[model samples]
Target: MSEVRVILHTDKRQALLREAQAEIRENQGRIPAGDFYARKLSAAWRRARGTRAYGPGEDQDDIGEFSLERFRDLPVTPRESLKAQPLRYAAVTPTEASEYYETTGTTGQPTPTPRLAEDTIWNTVSVAEAWRPLLGADERVVILLPSDVVPVADLVSGVCEYLDLAHIRAYPFATGITGWDRLEAMWRTFRPTTVFVAPGVALQFTRLLAQRGQLDELSSSVDRLACSGGGYTYTAAAGPGPSAARVGLARRTQGRPALPGGEASPGGRHCLHRPHRRTRAGRPG
Candidate 1:
């Protein structure tokens, strides 16, 4: 029952972060880099598992099939049974983890999503770099998403920290999550340049604002808006917004028809709080 302990050196961690950032900066968005990095991480996971984490006496892959060559194979993982209970899916033990996050589970019960610093460090670095182009270089952001262990708010806050953008995290959204009023108060005082929110909640919030005759104020206050989840139209990147404004939701973006928003769905979770691959730090289903 012994556990595997990965002692990643500081230099190696820094190197990983540097290379991840450089991958996006030097090459096309993430075409081949995503696959490349996934393989690299799989290898690292295998190495870290070593002669301890798997079981009492089980060592590394005994059959020598751990290699993951993209376009030709699947990456190595602990077991297929793990998928049935995703809340506990992880390469390391909770006690060994340097950090952790979880599902806001607005739809049902919550779940845990844990991780190590090594799994997150580069993912965090790469995300800030990826978002810099679409989200702007220095626009202050207000995250109006969940903030559980590794919720959207937490990740955006991390990206802002990495990129040096001024930002604030609103409380997690749910039926009675005592933070909408707080966010409104913050909006009045902080005047963030952009707002990141889920589509369902954003629509609800916008309706409430319109009822209070504050929609104009919101549009004028923030120059950019990023929306995640379905019910949005995706289009190629261009300067400014488009024209397909939703019914009863007239965006006050000067004369532009569409708002400066698109889907941030790298994974199923829509880490648009942020996500290159961020659900937990930067990876999720």
Candidate 2:
């Protein structure tokens, strides 16, 4: 018989585990009840509690009173645990699971998350409902995020499909049109009324188009500019810092004001600039 020994680098390992556990707790409440991912999480919690037992040398009298509450109080759903026992935690049967998305764990392990068909539709419908006010029924939306291969991309595409909008274009950040000319061509060809882009990409586009003197052309056709993923600050390119003039230029050219502190009209067409704070993640633009 051979025996294997395991050693723990106490300080580093404990710190990493603490951080991962905190993240799991923060994300737990936000998980949608109907989601297969959430159901899997519930199952994982149950299994972890069920298998935990007191050591043999432990007091016999305390055995019955010893509750799983102590173990449950400690975070048990770290990404590592999910990765180690994926099948045990999965809510959907193998035959029923259609989509699998993986998140990189703290230790660089891939944690697989299952998704059902109805979960896809529900997510799509939710996104469409949230953005419908900003995007009119006749408008076309250009998705300037990553390609629709990942979960985020799939959700965006699904939302657009559910909306029944005529045009939905996706430009991959990696290989799609980079220059102003190419971008302008795509924008014109697609004739998108609504442009959905991340704040970082939008800022880069603003800088590039401004330099090329093509900012107006891009902004002219876009009725609504939806800033997805994150927010930005509208500051001047030169002179007395982020002056009202420069900020206005950036906002007008970008077709949407900088998020967080900016205000939008009730109808959702026009944006009003004000002293505002940055918008939080998962918040509507």
Candidate 3:
């Protein structure tokens, strides 16, 4: 069962969504790739000096105009920097940051990654644009991902709010609150039309349904199942692909729809799975 449930009142969420939409509108729906990275890297460079190799230096003032050559010249921060000294990477102060989160440390040590209102709005709207076609106001979404210190749940919540779609968080791994049994009970009443889950968890849930002989009855209402996680290992030659699992869950569950992937620290996260047409051959994309 789920432990946390923080609902942003409808009015507040709408206001925030509008701000995100305006940002996209002003940029003409797409920001130049080079200019986006140039601004981000430049801001990161202006942070407080430290013993880190990429700290401020004499050449800090004159970062030339945005160009392919100039962008390449900018210092590239190593992935290990987050694990070594997380605070040094923060471009905003504690007061400025609206929310605080940390990674699962699956790949390495968990790192602190705080976010601002701007971060939430931008990420929400960007993903909503790509997912809007697949979602509708009449549909109800069930998000089966971890919410504590993880940005994926929050990102999905933001997208739902932005699109004015109904949604609920029912992470089955949340022991007492959203355990498999409890979630099964909730499904009877909620009757979600869409489900967003991780690949591993989705498989586990499917097995649970089949064991209980309720796979068809419980999954009948669900038409869409979107999975996102660290990495997908399913292969058509050996391991089970998404199509095989989808078939077990429900007859109506549609083809794979792309959703943005989240990191332990989900700052500036973007789409991971690309939308693909459903194939008769059932190949994993």
Best by lDDT: 3
- Tens digits of per-residue lDDT, candidate 2, 176-283, equal 445445666787687776666544555566566666665555555666555543133333221111221122223442544332212111111222122222122311
lDDT of all predictions: 0.50, 0.46, 0.58
Off by over 4 Å in 3: 1-19, 23-68, 105-107, 231-285
lDDT of 1 by residue, 234-277 (tens): 21111112211111222233322132222131212332322111
Candidate number that wins on lDDT, 2 or 3? 3
Prediction 3 global C-alpha lDDT: 0.58
TM-score of each: 0.63, 0.50, 0.68
TM-score: model 3 vs. ground truth = 0.68
Q: What is the lDDT of residue 186 in candidate 1?
A: 74
List of clashing residue pairs for candidate 1: 101-149, 101-150, 242-257, 242-258, 243-257, 243-258, 271-274, 277-282, 278-282
Please report how far candidate 1 places residue 41 from its true position, in Å: 6.6
What are the per-residue Cα lDDT tens digits for candidate 3 across 1-285?
A: 111113233577667767757755565436556576566555444442332334545454444344557557767668786678877667665666777777652245777776766566666676776677667779898887644446777777777876788889887777887799988888999998877766556667766776676765676677676655433322111113344334232122133223432332442232332222233364533
Clashes of 2: 2
C-alpha positional error of residue 18 in candidate 3 after TM-score superposition, expressed in Å:
4.8
Give Cα distance to truth, residue 126, candidate 2, Å.
Answer: 2.4
